[model samples]
Target: MDSKKSIHLLYAQYLANKISKDDLALLLDQLASMSTEELALLTAKFHSSEQISDLKNTEFNSQKTLAFIQDKIVVEEPRKRNKFTAWNTIIALAASISIFLLFKVIYQKDSSLFRATQDSSLSSISNQAYLSLILPSGETLHYSKDLQLLSNNSLALPTKDVKLNVLEKGQLAFEFSLEFIEKFKNKTYLIATGSQASCTIRLMDGTLVNMNGKSSIQLPTIFSKEFRTIALHGEAFFDVSHHKTWPFKISAKETEITVLGTSFNVKAYQSDSHVLTSLSSGSVALDNGTHQVKLTPGMEGYATKSKGEFNTRKISIQEIGMWRSGFFTFHEEPIIDIIQKLAQWYDIDDIQVVNDHRETFSGSLSKDKSLTQILKQLEKVSNSKFEITERRILIMR
Candidate 1:
């Protein structure tokens, strides 16, 4: 009559509904004393696909019993028990916490734990009121400004509202209230975003556009049409929400990307003569106002303005769109190209390439990292020497 064997028999009988109603109530009452680690183990076991399926396909009130069990799985640890449970309830508990901890160990031998999702009221919007974006070039810009940077666009504000601020030479922001959005229906709501380098925006339909530095997104004052649309100049990345009912469309330089649903990132900088569209999921068509090239996942379609031609090739997602993620993700990019990106993000007026073709580098870096940090990493990885002055950086390989 081993204690572990006796407990297993009791647990199995309880699962089989052989336990009485009073016994069930007593078990539920013991739940409040469980520890975080114990509860986490229980959660891991309860959320298993096999257990969930068993609970679902079973008959004879099994679903109710399972729900009841899951609800009682959350319990505060001994040290933090005072935070969640009443002191009276804590002392009156019949079962020892050790038994529960053993039960958890047996049920969740290998699964990991995750935090519980809290329920929220339905009145909230997904948008953030304020956010600071650091571009791949190292420019941290606050895109909260009046609608002044955008031509032919206007903003509506509350009576005593705080006017948004755009740091020294940063771009503008546009966050319209639902009411204002409704008022401007059909009319275009345009605004500039990104640092002297790049910026991003989420459309009404949940699609995101990364605005390469010095680009604008043209939107309807209010979205009423089926299509989510945008225009680009420099470069941009798009994780277009899959809207099978309507197409997500983007026009950049001389190229256009059209898809009903997909995960693709686009880059069309001014110095580059082409629009590079990299796909992550689904399919997209890259058109040069006349001819179009279809792209599959892992492939990038390059449409050049000079040749008026479309070329498709496979590329890594990190290599192209990491700019939106606040880092310069480069793959075989030349030193000159790296310098140009550094120039844009650091807001350097000019770059002197002491030795351009003699050197090149590759690596990932946080856009928020100071010039000194970036230079150090760059110098180390590229096997080059970096000399830093007040606002200029010199690289010698």
Candidate 2:
């Protein structure tokens, strides 16, 4: 068979579970030679309504599927075999499955219910010692700093310990553990930090992300040759990897921040009125179709979700990133707003402002303090007093 038609037929047979051992090897050998456009077409095929419906209803068993694929693979001596059977198909199957799962992951990523129902072990805790790592194949791994390393390899460590190195000037460094690097190429991952916890992660492309409490980020499965992109929910500080040809872009709510190389903080909690993008260094452009704003170092761009409009202003870079340094820096910020942040950082669920008094706080408070201690400090500064009840905090005048 000619190469082009063989490529089509090979995929067709594999999809139909009719591929022979020889055909599998042939497809494997040609995978590296196939252009990205050609592979994109195959990925598109998996998105058809019929295929998508089947995938949604089917329970995918990766181990069973791999075992079946392995049984069909055979190695043959070059002198005794044809071109198709010169090498075993195991390597080819691994590559093929990686591509197939990459598409499948992107397909199911938008399901809010699926994201909400991750393993209970990862989500049940109100406070977490480590960040939750959601694998592209929908596995959850929890790692803490207490883990002891037994090997130099990232994956060979005894436990999944995500390490963070604090740097000068509010910058943090994090490297993906070995287990993660294995799936880094073709799969995207969602890293989530709990309400009482914050974490820093470094993407495969060297972009550093400081995820605040109750925040999550959807990292691109693959940083495309054309652009590097990520989607954010809640808040994060991004130290982007610069590429002159490939700009780094972050999509948060209705607003998008595009930068070639810059450090910025984005806040887009679902409950907030505006999406805030504050630049720490270099330059960033914020866009929401109807409006656009360019921000330089020590400036912030705010986009109102309701109006789809944007505005810019000068801001303090230290205030923008103080949360990473275990402090909440407020500058005449509303009392309710401060309470909301306190609730999120401390995992206090039933916080209510009983009085709608117009009071704003302007100061910095250490996050390491207890809830009562911080509340007492705030009360000493503002007109509000805190009343602690059973599992609730009431702010009254």
Error of 1 at 298 (Å): 0.3
Clashing residue pairs in candidate 2 are 154-178, 155-178
- Residue-level lDDT for 221 in candidate 2: 51
lDDT of 1 by residue, 1-397 (tens): 6643544444444555454434444555444444556455454643454543343211112223334344444332224444235433433332323234333443343221100000011011111112332211122223333323222112332422223333333433345556544554444534444344454466657666666554445555444455666555446677777878888777665566789887777766555557778888889987664577898888998855544678778877546566776787666777767766766566444555566465546676788887678777776666567676765667676
TM-score of each: 0.51, 0.62
Worst lDDT window (10 residues) for model 1? 114-123
Model 1: pairs clashing at backbone N, Cα or C within 3 Å: 137-345, 194-198, 194-199, 197-213, 234-268, 235-268
Q: Report the C-alpha lDDT of model 2 over 1-397, residue by residue, as the tens digit.
A: 7887787777777666566666676765564456556655665664465554445422233333444444445423234665454334434565555444433343335332222333322353234544555555554545454422222223543334346455554444445566655655544566667765776676768788888887777664556776787778778898888888999977676676899988989987656788888889999998774678889899998865554667788887777777888898888888888987787677666777777868776888898898889989888877898888875789899
User: Model 1 off-target regions past 4 Å?
Assistant: 1-183, 194-200, 210-215, 224-226, 317-320, 354-358, 380-397
Give the range where candidate 2 is weakest over 10 consecutive residues by summed lDDT.
112-121
Residue 269 deviation, candidate 1, in Å? 2.5
Alpha-carbon error at 371 in model 1, in Å? Answer: 2.5
**Number of clashing pairs, model 1?**
6
After aligning candidate 1 to the native by TM-score, how far in Å is the CA of 136 from where it should be? 28
Candidate 2: which stretches are off by over 4 Å? 1-48, 51-126, 145-186, 389-391
